[model samples]
Target: MRETRTMRPRAAPNRLIAAAGLLTATMTTVATAQLLPGVPASPREKGPDELARMSLLPERVGIPVGGSAWVLVRLAIEPKWHVYWRNPGDSGVPVELKWTLPAGISAGEIRWPRPEVFRTPYEITYGYADEVGLLVELKASEEIGTGARSASIRGDWMICKEMCLIGGADRTFEIEVSGAVEADATDSDRVPITDSEAFAAIARWQAQVPVAPPEKMKLRQMVEFPNGFRADANENAGVLRLSGPAGRFSEVRFLPDATPGTTYPEGGPVEGRVASGRFEVEVPISVRPGDALGEALRAAGIVCLGNARTDPAFEIEVPIGPPTAGGSTAP
Candidate 1:
């Protein structure tokens, strides 16, 4: 099978100027949505707006000064239609977020939930189905006064099923800022008094966020390519041996994110399997010549156990040291 990568389009210079003006002026709520050309909506499928509904939900009733408040960018996707994840695997663009925040307030990166794997004969992708909530923490400066602040966010995504449709929505929110949080208050006490359902939804998605592997389940090293990794080596193929308790998981898979100047071979022997008390995955690494390497020397991906949505997943970064002397390939 051939691997294909999909990327989001860039705006022209004129469009960039117009967008900058729009962002600086006022963020108008775009009620309607637009579909990308060529890929028409199927008769059985819903329209762009109907396919995905974007809304904002706050974790607390008021933002605490000198502290951060969590707000969820909830996407209620129609059944059978899905939105891409941070990696988006072999194809598709991940959902993008653009925020217009009040002065003295800043937005944090979206904490992505675990993504489901979607595979077909042509390509493999990772994304979400049904409802998915993305948590974005908004931080306020200590000098900011207590009052109500207005903020707006826009979400752009590519929802696909039998056909793909690019769509976006704008959501406006009024955030209430208060004094510093009390030192005696417990974690639960800081939760939103209102929006019980929203808080629960955020908590649910927060639980799905991938975390580091436990101490007992840490990766030891690569077994097959012990001579060290060479980005310029011929047919750079090896096995990533993860030492962990096995037999508990029936399936194992690796969903790779984008790494500049490097690529992972897809399909064929390039897959993962569980054996003994370890999870071993065959990784075929290829890289461009004379590449300026820094973080690119390390391989990063999500190691999924059993079912991606329901089972436990761990985020791993394997260091690829320099090749053996003379920059030779592993025998």
Candidate 2:
């Protein structure tokens, strides 16, 4: 067994935002020290028994001018060790990426695959074990000059089993951007690019990305208080009712978005119950004192179902209204 040591300055809370009526959360890990660009850290500094390995992988073929391509920041973890998800449930930090791109080039958000639930003696967390791929989309400006180009990425993550260790790496790779061929009178010119095994691996992980809930599922909001507004609003709690096709899900669990001072009930499970060929689960929400519930609270999370590795996980964002006289409102 590999020995691990505790690290200082725990992971920071995730930030939440509601844009265009859509609830989205950005996961970030605080860095104790930022490494300068182009400087690669020696992996040996962390010893050979490190829990995870990091690398950058680009598509096999060159990119076309004014076109976009995908790059993967791959993390291969040792057995029994795991890294965190965008929302690292009870504890843990999400992987952070810092990029050094050439002029006229940009990187998009990291597209995370659905993560597994990991329970510890003290708390439950969301993370991935074995291997995980973090995909990043790279785009080139239309005015980009055709030639050879390169970019560097710095990745930082926390790996843990019983103890935690912080690890990071800097990887730089070259990008080949080819000039666009002139189009013929009848057909549009298309860039020729061959797919590699790496591309196939990315495809597999992309399928695991959570998608919006299907039409059959209906989401609603409910509020509960001991004595309405007369009682302490801090005692007030929110609930989300998700009713969907029961047969499709043998079991379901909800992982709430990570926000400071906002949390789900400790040790409480959000398991789905089946009745009349439909499944329903109520997710509880608790807000700490001085934390505003806002006029419209958007509850964002993943709805995971079943035990099979291929089981489906749907992404859901339910907008909850303020406390009403009836203690509930339609979603």
Candidate 3:
């Protein structure tokens, strides 16, 4: 595997135009923050946990015998405040989770919901405002004893508005261990699920999590070095082309996962508007040579449909190959 990389799409029109759009967004956010009552005037004006609260919501009352269940780490943020996403973009700390579980029970990675793009005068960040649900699946071993068990979790995050504050909370709960039940088992024989509202809420957030793009939507990537591989300056750039069902979407955008050694520069071309069911965007990449290149210079990120953060989003990882000798450019 190669170092983590930053993937940001140079917005449409041009750099100046994109900057103007971003500036407008920044201003709007600032204005919204100002309008919110009780917002901190300075970064250190309030207590660390004053802006955000955390809770855990398990989907089922029990981890089914030899099966798994999902639990959500929910964040409730104050007005105009937000918590970072996995790739926090220019600056911000993402939410971190630590779980203490009984033996034979393991937790899976967090299933992040599609994030909202936030722009400041100097940088861009991805995060969720108001509230968000991050799903973590817990699996129980088939040979484990059947009884009740205690599970605990701690969530740490940096909540932000005009400024930022680090916050954390710990929660513990009980889970029943039920024996395997037959397929035809009556409702009483099976472990019950959480309340309907809670169950539906979890499902709604699950739908926001990015997954593999469907086969029908063709997605592709390619790299081009305008200065012919300037390792010294870290000047590497590329393009992405995607196809979708006719009229199914009006626009597309890409948000790269954080890679250790890669940087996405500003002032790159923008090409994400859908034209005749095709979407394309130029992603500015800066790769430090002697680090890694070739097939290892891969890009992984979320492909969001529509401008709204809650809209449908898909995940993609594409190899970075040199531009074909006579490679065709997106029209």
Q: Which runs of model 3 end up more than 4 angstroms from their true locations?
A: 1-46, 181-192, 221-237, 267-271, 289-297, 320-331
> Looking at candidate 2, what is the lDDT of residue 132?
90
Error of 3 at 183 (Å): 7.4
Tens-place lDDT digits, model 2, residues 1-331: 0111112111111110111013211223233343334646675433212467775554232455565667777888888889999988777899889988889888898888888888878888888999898887777776777666656777888888877777776766665565543333111223222334545766777777776776656543333433332223454465666667756666777767664434566663477776777667777766443454343345667776776545777776655445566765445
TM-score, candidate 3, is 0.73
Q: Write the per-residue lDDT of candidate 3 for residues 199-224, one digit (tens) a residue.
A: 67778898889887677666555555
| Winner on lDDT (2 vs 3) | 3
Cα lDDT over the full model 1: 0.66
lDDT of each: 0.66, 0.62, 0.64
RMSD of candidate 2 to the truth, in angstroms, is 14.4
| Per-structure clash totals for the candidates | 0, 0, 3
TM-score for all models, in order of appearance: 0.76, 0.71, 0.73
On lDDT, the candidate that comes out on top is: 1
Top-TM-score structure, candidate number: 1
